[model samples]
Target chain A: MNEKKSSAGLKLCISDLSMSFGGVQALEGVSFEVEPGTIHAIIGPNGAGKTTLINCISGQFIPEGTMHFGERELTHVRAHNRIQMGIARTFQHVNVYSELSVLDNIMIGGHHRLKSNWIRQCLYWGPYGCSREEQMLQAEALELLERLEMRHLADSPAGELSYGQQKRLEVGRALLAHPKLLLLDEPMAGMAKQEKKQLSDWILDINREMNITIVMIEHDMTVVQTLSDQVVVLDFGRKIAEGPPQEVVKDKRVRKAYLGED
Target chain B: MEPNLTDKDAGTAAARPLLETRLERYGAVGLILALAVGSMLISSYHLSLLTTITIFAFSAMGLNLLSGNAGLISIAHAAFMGLGAFTAAWFAIDLGIPILIAIILAGIVSAGVGLLFGIPSLRLSGLYLILATFAAQIILYWFFEQALWLTKSPDGRFVGIPEVMGFEFGDPWHYYLLVLVFTIAGAVVYLNILRSGLGRSLEVIKERPIVSQMMGVNLQRTKLIAFTIGHFYAGVAGALYGWHLQFVATEAFDLMGSIELLVMIIIGGLGSLAGAVLGATFIVVVPELLDMAGRRLVDDMGLMAPIRMFIYGLLVVIFLIYEPHGLARTWRKLVRYFNKKLFKNKNEH
Candidate 1:
């Protein structure tokens, strides 16, 4: 099956983003540029503001900074509108709608693309009826399921899925948005070794096949080292190192921060 | 590696076949048949009882969508209903409009009111949202009492028997058919909406607003839609109530009425359409049944009111303790049992 890559992904530029909660600063003067069609990983220890940076980019947390996606300013863009602009993110925890069927969960990710009006939807008329749009949505959602190798689980309630499967489902949901830039927060966390390998392979395939840029937060050093094209290391809400994984890992500050050396 | 199935998976798997069985397919047919049999077998007085149940069921279904599906509590649902009732009455009497058109107009007016009150829900949720709806109830009640021109009920407003295309619906049997048709239509609309994208979005919003936002759901728009549709159902029910009683009174739609509607959805099953019907029947019929039983022991209607209220309170408490998911879940369980017993062989293939 052929997948269309829209816009070849867009550059994401974050300039001097600062965020604090009460007395604790989560991300301070954080600046970075994620080039189009590349896997960018943000790695840091606990409370290092890695997740906070993702939140700021996704518009969940407003910070003192300017953000640009492609040439479009996104600092004031609402969270819901960010998806329409081809930016999608998953949660630190697997946050698929637990009560919905797996198919429905994926279909929801395609909501911004469905153009059926409320009246047509209420009456099941026009595109909202048993028409092209309806069929297309179902087909697209099924294709997404097939891509994740989760076609058999489409009818199952999402919450009933195992933790590893839920994480995959979350990724599939974000992919359904056809995002130019995908932000995955701990996508491989809490997975078994086999499951982690499978997820890493899927993430690699998603990046290479779909040509979608990715910004991910992961503590799995091995996966980050193998998959990331660029790595940004954070400590105490500050960027400690920004380079390729091999060099960043060898950096003195990164090693000291990770090993907690005096 | 073998798939890891949790207890929830086991439970849902056990229940899945029941939902998919032939019996489930016939559920709608069964409901229609029951309504048909009821209309044919019951006496005029009992037909009135059925009509009242059907009317209340409409309002309860609305509340079910708002409180059950959307996870937004509304104590002002009856106020939306009351708005519909008064609007229909005003249209029918003051403007000399047709009753059918008046009923439709009433629904639209109530939807408008619902949209107005729903603004608060976009910013508030849980207890705060509930409190806001309660304020709506009080405000609407005060509006009904003070706005004499709108209500035209200084004492109590008497509405003429509704006539649609020269057919008088004053007779219980005739009104029963009307109410039954409207109720069924309302149910069809409710069920259809649930299958729609808008309905799914509302569920997403209810489950996780942040996740929903990430999934591109407009939180404010979805909430407003839920409120509008839910209250449209209420408005239709309220107009039907006016036709049933042929009278309008401010006291009929007080906070207690709102609470009663909420109770119906709670006892019937929140978020289930069948539960809405079951709850409406329970709230409406159970009280009359109790009143009949109580009348044998007590003497006056005035004295019986308090006894009825006491019984309702007791029943709600009992339901909360034992069947919190409400009668709909109980009904589903019973159906599942029968389906398993009757269709076990057929389903195994």
Candidate 2:
């Protein structure tokens, strides 16, 4: 079945983004560019401000930075508006609406795409359009569930899912937004080895099939080396290494940051 | 590779709506019919009780949506009702606006005022929303009491007997039917809204505002809309209430009224329209039944004031502890049990 997704990814450019909490500088003049339709992984140790950088790109932070998605400047765009511009993200922790059905939780990601006059929609008049819009959305969400091979679990509450499955649900929810740029904050964190491999494959599928640019923050070096086309390593709130995954792993500063000074 | 589920559970899954669609399809009609039957079969003596249940349910359904989906418990809901009743009464009585138009206008005006109070919901929720709306109730009641020109009398205000075309809804049965139509309309509208995109947003907003916002749902706007729609229902219900009693009194729409609506929604269930109706029925009918029993036992008109409050508090505790999802979840469980039991009995037969 043909999937209706956002037209291929946009160039995500982040420049001079510096954010600090009081004296605790989480990200300082951190800059990176993610080419369209590629997986760009950011690797860092504990408190390296990896998540902070992702948050900034996803409009969760207003750091001293200029962000450009395609031609649109997102320096001042709010979180919700960033999603409107096709920037969707998953949290570091799995954040599914536990009380909702699996399908219902995914459908929440598509609500902003609902385009109908608010007044007419409220009345539920057939010709007024929102009812029809929702029917189409339900079908779309169901199709997405089917593609994720989670069609049978559609009726079950999200809380009942295993931890790894919850992570996948969070990713599925993000995908439903038809994001041009997907920011995954620690997508592999806290997953079993097999689950990590499975999620890495799913991330690859999301990138290839949807033609979406992915900015993932991960600590799994093996998974990152295999999946990502490019890599940026951060240590102490600063970019220490940038190149192909294999080269970045061998960089002097990156090795020193991970293994301590030689 | 994924979690395993039994086939029996799959059957239940097939019966479920993604969210609120099934209720609109079957439950909404079933509720309206049951009330219609109640109107016919019940004694004219209890006709007023039936009418009051539907009227309260109209607004209770609104609170049901706000509290159930948005996770907002509004203590000022009754105050908004008071606002609508007064606005509709003022338009109809003072300015001589068409009564039906005035009622609709009253709903809009109440929504506007509710939006003002709902601003607090943007920064707060749960117990905090209750506190914020509590202040709203007190403030609105103060306005209702002090605005002598609106009521035309310092004591209370009276509205004319409602007339449409040549027919007058002066009789109890006629008034019941009129209120019934409005309540049914409210139910249908509530169902439709729930089955749509706005309903989806509220569901996510309730669970996690951060997730909803990340998905491009304007969190502030959605919460405000919940407040708006909830108050719109309160206003319409208040207008119908005004005509039902032929009076707009501050005492009727006080903290007690808001508490009563909250109790109805909680006891019935939060998210479902069916729960809202059942809750309204339980809250209204149980008390009146007790009142009747008390009257026969004591030979007194003032049978319950303090006693009723104690009962509501107790019932809320019982429901919250035993069936936290409220009566809707219980209703679903019963339906599922019967479906299996009846099928087994048929196979045996």
Off by over 4 Å in 1: A1-7, A125-132, B1-21, B297-304, B337-349
Candidate 2 docking category?
acceptable
TM-score against native, each model: 0.92, 0.91
lDDT of 1 by residue, A1-262 (tens): 1133445678999999899999999998999999888889999889999999998888888899899999999988988999999999888988988988998898788788777766666666444452345446666677679878899999899999988888888888888888888999999888888888888888878888778899999999998998898999999999989998989989999988964664
User: Residue B38 of model 2: what lDDT?
Assistant: 69
Residue pairs with colliding backbones in model 1 are none
Candidate 1, residue B267: lDDT: 89
lDDT of 1 by residue, B56-138 (tens): 99888888888888888999988889889998999999999899999989999999899998985679998999999999999
Best by DockQ: 2
| Cα RMSD for predicted model 1 | 5.5
RMSD of each: 5.5, 5.4
lDDT of 2 at B90: 91
